[model samples]
Target: MSNDFYTSSILPYAAIIVKICRAYTNTQEDFEDYYQEVCLQIWRSRKNFNGQSEWSTWIYRLTLNVCLTLLKKKDRQHVASDYLPDEASEGSHVFADESLNQLYDAIKQLSEVDRGIILLYLEEKSYKEIADIIGSNTNNIGVRIKRIKERLKKLLNGKVN
Candidate 1:
């Protein structure tokens, strides 16, 4: 990707990409890798964007799709434990809040689709917007969000086994 594109097009939305990537990755290294791939894919696929939806919406959909797809591929090509980072590298800001960390840890436990749904919901996207991004029925999105919230509450309370 060009530096101009990275700075102008992708960098402006890096926070969104980072949040989506964080939801899908367990380790700092994995988060970096997924973030990079998502940026690359977004640039490569930019032409395919027809401007039917808002730019942020398109970016959200692209980020979630890239993270989930890369996660599945990573699962198939498992790396040895020795290669994994021992402790998270210190710049990620994800651990800044004790409660936020717990919330995300719980979010990470959700299935891929559920994780994306909850992340979008947490972003304050309306149910209709989330349905548009996730390509689910709006009515179903409300039901799913309610269920995901309950699941997350249980997770937070240490009730999930």
Candidate 2:
């Protein structure tokens, strides 16, 4: 990808890429790797974008797909680490708030598809938009989100296994 394209198109949405990648990775090394892979895929797949959705929506879908793919490959190689590093030490302000970090910790316990759904929901994406990104109907997306929220609540309350 051209430097101009990277600066103009992808840099503005770096936070979206970072947030999705952070959710799927365990350590700082994996997070950086995932972040770089997502950006590269976005640049490589730029031509596949057809303008059917907003640019951010396309980015979200692409970022989620790349992270999920990389995560599955990692899972196949070995189990993911249960430990989370201090976000401060990683030099990322994304999870600066303790409560937010706790929330993400709970989120990590969810299934991969659920992880994507909840992340999109938390971003305040409309159910239709989420459904589109996730390839599900709006009604199904609504139901799954309700269940996911309940599960997350249990996790946060230390009630889940």
How many clashes would you count in candidate 1?
A: 0
Report clashes for each candidate as comma-separated counts.
0, 0
Model 1 per-residue lDDT tens digits across residues 23-63? 87767678888998999999999999999999889999999
* Model 2 residue 22 CA deviation in Å: 0.9
TM-score of 2: 0.87
Tens-place lDDT per residue, model 2, 14-114, is 97788788888766778889998998998899999999999989999999999999977876786456333434234453467878777877878888999
Off by over 4 Å in 1: 79-94
TM-scores for every candidate against the unseen true structure: 0.88, 0.87
What range of 10 consecutive residues in model 1 has the weakest lDDT sum?
82-91
C-alpha local distance difference test of each model: 0.85, 0.85
Error of 2 at 11 (Å): 1.9
